[model samples]
Target: MYNLAKYQKLKNKINRIERAELGFFPTQIYKLENLSARYGVNIYLKRDDLSGFSTFGGNKIRKLEFLFGEILEQGAQNIFTYGATQSNHALQTAIACRRYNLNPILYLVDVIGEGIKDPKANILLDKVLGAEIKIIEFKENEDEFEAMYRAKAESKNYAQEISESEDDYYLIPPGGASPLGTLGFVNAYLEMKAQEFKEDLNFKNVFHATGTGGTLGGLTAANKFINDDIQVHGINVSHKDDSYLKEVAELSTAALNLLGIDFKLSDRDIIVDNNYVGAGYEIPSTRANRAVKIFAEDEGIFLDPVYTGKAAAGMIDYLEKGKIEKGSDLLFWHTGGTNALFAEKKILGNLLDNHI
Candidate 1:
């Protein structure tokens, strides 16, 4: 059902956008033979976890390739981003900035009470990269969202004070959810489509973790662009309200517009399964821990507690509940955050427990 002419046109439109080479292209896609047998469906994986720039690569690398391209084009020297103390986005941004010789300033919220002592996982990686790190703790009566908003405001003020000129610094939103960053996943969607055509396979469903919504927005936009019927399902890693779908739709439309595409996406076109977000973001769930072990033991692949583990658990649940039809073809996008395995015990939960 893929039209070569249309695909080529879309590819051309995407190629016109500026991008910095950051990660390896078309990060491996292959069949998950063992899981397929277990689930009674044809299972495949888009290995974005191996999307390299570092050994701990993840989904953020794709967004940074475009985001940094824009920052470099504008000739900014200082890059400021906000996230949790162990944010994969913040870590990836710091890595990309180091490669481009730009300064990375991170305003990170302490969501898991990492405290002021020795840091671990991505936080430790940020320090090793020499990023100017500022940890923001949640004040009394403040929730995670409030603390995140405060972190952004505080980072903006700090950037203004340190920058010699407005052009000297650039601010990136958490998860790189901006339109330009969303374009990275739009490109990723095309990459998957190309693979699908080459392999003569038609995927009925696509699954991945959704946080700030940029990746979901881009993939949805690309699906709309090609008029594909593949159902792209986002498994929430955190709590999000009904408005989250609308926000993702807006992001998708904006990214499509950047490519001169006239198609628009609405909330009706988005799909999110929130059933797997056990105990909210960064807090591991029993099913997710079980899913992690299953993947490692069966497929020899690792998934982080924060993102991929939750999404994978959701996919498995759908299959088990008969929400997805037997014999359906499924693609799981491994967006990567395996570094979190070495993070705090709270995030890791009972992952290694024999009873999980």
Candidate 2:
């Protein structure tokens, strides 16, 4: 129920932003003929994985586009954000901050070991991007981590330490899921929707991993603006609880409001299935590994076990179970986290052992 005139106007603004060349290009969308034929459904991949720029480009970069734009518009000199030890969002935030010549300070929670030997591959990129890292123990209260980081960013002494003035912007939780930030993914959806007509195909369901929820939320809200029939399914790769669901809904509502789209979305619109995550966020599940191998073997596509693999597994499960009707076009979004594959070498040791 989004206003078409306002949606078109928002799409125009997004197109202007795209002309700036802030991130990579259209990141291909090719049909997965084998998988489609096997499953008796039309399947395509929106390869955000190919979003170029130091391997940091992915769905998160789309979100960072608007976030960094706001930071620059505010005349901020430094950027602050927090995440786990190896956060792709944090790494990409550092990259965008560098492009804008703004200093980035990353607060990592429960991080172990410095400089290499970290189980997360983004650690190396974090250092390479020259983002100042602070480790925090979050066992007691998670709010302390945010309070301490925000205080540090606001401190005159800390501002001098990063060689910045008191006027700087700090990004709140999970790559700025605010309405302003979600504009990036909303534009991305517009891009895909344009491609839909050119490809002569109609997509029914769009699936992606819901981690911090920004990508899925923005995409879902934008979908309502573009095509109401397009349903976005967010496969939760993190803990599936009420809090996470609420976060997704809130972000989606913000996104809708940002574009001046008056759309009423219920809980049913936000579909999050959390049956796949085996352990924690970075841990790999057995089903995800199998999905990775199957995709590699069948489509010659490599997927990271943490995000894309689990998402693909959920998509496949939905396909096999009749949830996704036959001939209903399915688009699986590849949010790149492939670097996490090499970070956890022990888990992949058996695959290499065969050749060794």
Candidate 3:
């Protein structure tokens, strides 16, 4: 479905860009036996979950490679960023900082207002990583957009202020969704394609959870470059409107532009299905919880409630609804947030219920 020659060409093209070796590359791609039998489709998994630097390896580690390379190139000693209290990106950033002995300052917004003082999951990891964390809890009846904007504005203001005074600080955008960060996934796309080629697998669909848009942007851009028959699917794990779609499309172009690839990405290239985001952000749904359990039970693989599990739910629904034909080749990109399985109960959403 993709060219092996273009894979080498992409490598030669992106090798010019500086990047830190933060995690082991070429994450495993393998088929799921039980799930494939159940779904009546060839369901394979790209185990980016096993991406190692720490045991908490995730898709964020890929973004960090390029991001930290840029940071080290600039000789940055301190870094600042924003995310939710339990963000996988924030925790991964902290881990990367520890490796470089760079100080990490995380200004986190409390989307769920679950009293994060007793940290769990990624928040606990941040503390272990010695990240200076400032949690922002929203006021009663406050608008979510207002709260998010205010938190980000304040975080950047503080970062800029500190940078002006004592030392320069590198500020990464939330979820590391910057154009440079998106390049990590562009590289990831090439890597996965190479694996598929080596295994002689032809995938018709590639599905993953989409948040912050960087990963999706990179994938869309690379898919355009390869012109493969594969359908890149982004199952929205959170709220996203047409504006978000357009923004991601622009980011796709920007990432391709960064790679010196002259390609224009349209709205058609970015296929986002927002149907799986039940309730709201960080709020788990029944389908997602079931999906998480199903993966764990059937394939002995873990999927978190927030991201990959929701995406799994979408793929499951598609299979059930005949959106994916029987015997079709499908690939699920496990972006890795299994830590959230041990997170707060509110987010877990009875994932442990109906147990033996």
Q: Which candidate comes out best when scored by lDDT?
A: 1
Model 3 superposed RMSD (Cα) = 1.9
Each model's Cα RMSD: 1.1, 3.8, 1.9
Candidates arranged by TM-score, highest first: 1, 3, 2
Worst 10 residues of 2 by lDDT: 347-356
Q: Determine the backbone clash count of candidate 2.
A: 0
Q: Tens digit of lDDT per residue, candidate 2, span 17-86?
A: 4222357767789999889898999999999987857656778777777776667767787677767666
Q: What is the C-alpha lDDT of each candidate?
A: 0.91, 0.72, 0.87
Q: Name model 1 segments beyond 4 Å from true.
A: 2-4
Residues 35-98, candidate 3: write the lDDT tens digits. Answer: 9999899999998888967898989889889999999988877788778889889988999999
* Residue-by-residue lDDT tens digits, candidate 1, 234-332: 999999889999999999999988888788899999999888999988999999999999899889999988999999999988888888878878999
Q: Count of backbone clashes for each model?
A: 0, 0, 0
Top candidate, metric TM-score: 1
Candidate 1 vs candidate 2: which has greater lDDT? 1
